[model samples]
Target: MSTIELKNLVISKISEVNDEAFLLAINTILDSKSESILILSDDQKSSIKKSQKEYLEGNYFSNDSVNEEMEKWLKQ
Candidate 1:
């Protein structure tokens, strides 16, 4: 298969994953191989970089924050 086709298949399989650690490993491997692989689009590359930075900086929201938002929506 072509490189882009292989990347698409890998991305599709990655999306089917639900385990956080496994996803991180997959992303890390992809990043390491990036120089030798097809470049990700600007948006996709930005999103991955942003998410990794957020994760590294402990910038994620809590489940309670989501629950509170949901409750507020229900009350409206």
Candidate 2:
């Protein structure tokens, strides 16, 4: 069926219902559609920007190098 038809069908079905808990659950599901944005702190923002700069400057370790270091540490 089309989107409008489906929505209308749901509305008709919901109107015939009288269960408080079920209606609350439906309301919660609808409310979750628009999620809130994350608010980052100054320190976190600075750290992310610093990491991005480091990445752009090619100062980061390779995955193979990190794995080798982890293996050495684990063996010790």
* Candidate whose TM-score is highest: 2
Query: lDDT tens string, model 1, 12-72?
Result: 9988999999988888988888867777899999999999999899998899999999999
TM-score per candidate: 0.40, 0.60
Model 2, which residues run further than 4 Å from truth? 1-17
Query: What is the Å distance of residue 69 in model 1 from its true position?
Result: 76
For residues 4-64, could you state the per-residue lDDT of candidate 2 as single tens digits? 9999999999999899999999989888865556679999999999999999999999999
Pairs that clash in candidate 1: none
Clash statistics: count for each candidate: 0, 0
What C-alpha lDDT do the candidate models reach, one value each?
0.91, 0.95
Q: Distance from true position, residue 15, model 1, in Å?
A: 0.7
